[model samples]
Target: MTAPQCPVAHEVFDQQYMRDPYGTYASLHEKGPVHRIMTPEGFPAWLVTGFEETRDALADRRLVRSIEYAGEDYRTLPLPAEFSTKTVATEDGAEHMRLRKFMNKSFAIKRVRALRKRVVELTDGYIDAMGESGETDLMTAIALPLPITITGDIMGVPDEDRANFQYWTDSMLGINTEVVREAGATMLGFLKRLIDDKRTNPGDDIFSDWIAWTDDDGKHLDDHELIGLGFMVLLGGYDTTVGMIGGGMLALLNDRPKLERLRANPEQIPDAVEELLRLYGTAHTGVRRFATEDMTIGGVDIKKGDVVLCSMGAADRDPARFENPDEVDLDRPNLTHIAFGQGPHYCPGSELGRMEIAIAIETLLRRLPNLELAAPADSVQWREAYLIRAPKAIPIRY
Candidate 1:
């Protein structure tokens, strides 16, 4: 395909857009499936908002995840050597498959199912500690701690070190460069110690399994791969699940009628969870992919090395793909949303994420029938991250 001159970039990441991204997406969708937009970081990229376009772009092999393919103008955070290893998100083709295959076993359906009882126990325990709640921040009380603890257990992080582990994770996500670098180094050191311990004394955890796993050719993950994979799993499962839980609960609590329906018939909680993900999945955009060659998406000419961001947040709620796209419909006929993304790069931890959200919501509905927002819905604050969509905190009374 022949490439055309890039279109004028649309400015769409301002405060208004962050506050009501769905509204911003709706406006973008009305304009076209794909758009040339200036990211908050002051770089030009294509934002695919149409459901079909986003789905097709996600599965498109020509759009790759590696930073090497990026245009010179594309900017990204600098990582230290210890944190620069190729991970599932950074590799493509066979290497990606190899990494994904190894990680998949840890989150397989049966294994995730086995953790259901434990998830319920943890959820109940956290809520119990809330002391029947007068008013509390749901993010700390349940959303953040639950996933942190669960993913911590999976990584075999000792109970005493979990607080420090959480701190490192939070610091790594902060905006300060020095803090991020320091946190990355500290976290890498901690993970290396944990890996060494697992090697000497294996356990029923993902890290130990990665340490023991050998491919058909008797090849094992090298030190770099092991650390990279461990870091990815630990961070990936924590922030995204926390966002989903907090966002999903906010969606329910905002809608009294639908919330009541689920409470009346707890069996429908799974379906409600799907709808919640469709509307409020934390991954606002798929990982940035650079075009390997000139291509056309939704009629927009994308040149080689141009950065492309498939907006799952926009696509899943596209009115054309979904009827009444803005509202949640638990009985919605088609639940196959691209919130977890699509194709080979689709989220490996999807089953585990679904299980966690379902269990958390179900437990909340059953235990706290009177749960309500402590403040007006509009007063709730949302995190100002371009890649992630979640509330900064959810104040509630039960």
Candidate 2:
């Protein structure tokens, strides 16, 4: 005998859904851990709602990420051009190991820790610029610029070209097909030129490292791979960090008591960052995985070729793994939240991202102790997209 189907008719992509996904996810968990539902793009897929199931799915070799291994039926699902970019995100097994190995040194703990002083200096500059404004769009003045600047430096983006890089990156996140195409093309062209420039004048940056990296097998990234990896790294390092900074700040500001608690003892900033990430992760969805064979997750039958969208946000808030999952608890002992995701493809820049966010919060509290949201919490508009769950702007006053 087989388990009966339990298809859910929930809308996974609505703006309202993005606003209160934890609530919706809780309801979905009532139906079951795995729900067959429509994606924001209006395609059907399986969403894993359970904590353990999502963790397992992320590391499951049976759930292949490359569309090359996708079942014929699942192949019809529309994929962003980024999918075909052949970056680390798209590969698995040996090829993934090769790419991960080559990129490891650049993100190693020592390298990321060495960036702390730079991050502090950058944060102070941004705060100084915000000095007399009295009120400012935190997103524009601080959250967005800090990480973008750092990633720009790391990728060797010319200071003069950063404005264009910002435009292309923002456009790449657009839902409009024409805009995405134009932005993608412009970014690719920019990256090609950047890579070419690095060939003759290699600098002490990740781009130069990728150009010069080698392993025992003599493996290295070619120009094409470099372009993909470069764009992916930039997007990963900037967008997600911005989201965490902005979102985490809101989480702190909204709860004055908690804010004051952390303010009183800054030693807990790291743990507070972990709790903030767990409560409201930057991404609601995880990397898409296609089932290579029939499987049952949390007692739901998933067929071969079916696309599984693991909801990391949903998993993080699962009651089974978290107590008072929706509330931000700085003392939450278990920081096993998969905000940066889990398994082999775990975000390469997570440590750096955490440092950026923690420093951003600490700097704000110290510099502007009276900082408060300039608008009502409910009025802050969130991005109406599935890819990133972040506010459009976080207006603030000190």
lDDT of each: 0.85, 0.81
Model 2 pairs whose backbones collide? none
Tens-place lDDT per residue, model 1, 108-188, is 889888898999999999999988769999998999888988998888889887887556656666445677778888888
Q: Model 1 residue 309 lDDT?
A: 95
Q: Could you report the Cα RMSD, in angstroms, for every candidate shown?
A: 2.3, 2.1
Query: How do the residues 1-398 of candidate 2 rate in per-residue lDDT, one tens digit apiece?
Result: 33333454345555667676766877777766787876644456888878998999888888878877565445332224543547788888888878887667789999999999999999999999987559989889888889988898888989887777556756766566677777777787888899899998999899999999876688778777787688778778888888899889988889899999988899999888988898778877876788888998878788888889888988888988888888887777757888988888889999999999999999998888879999988788877656667778988999
Top-lDDT candidate index? 1
Residue 67 of model 2 has an lDDT of 77
Mark the 10 consecutive residues where model 2 has the least summed lDDT: 74-83
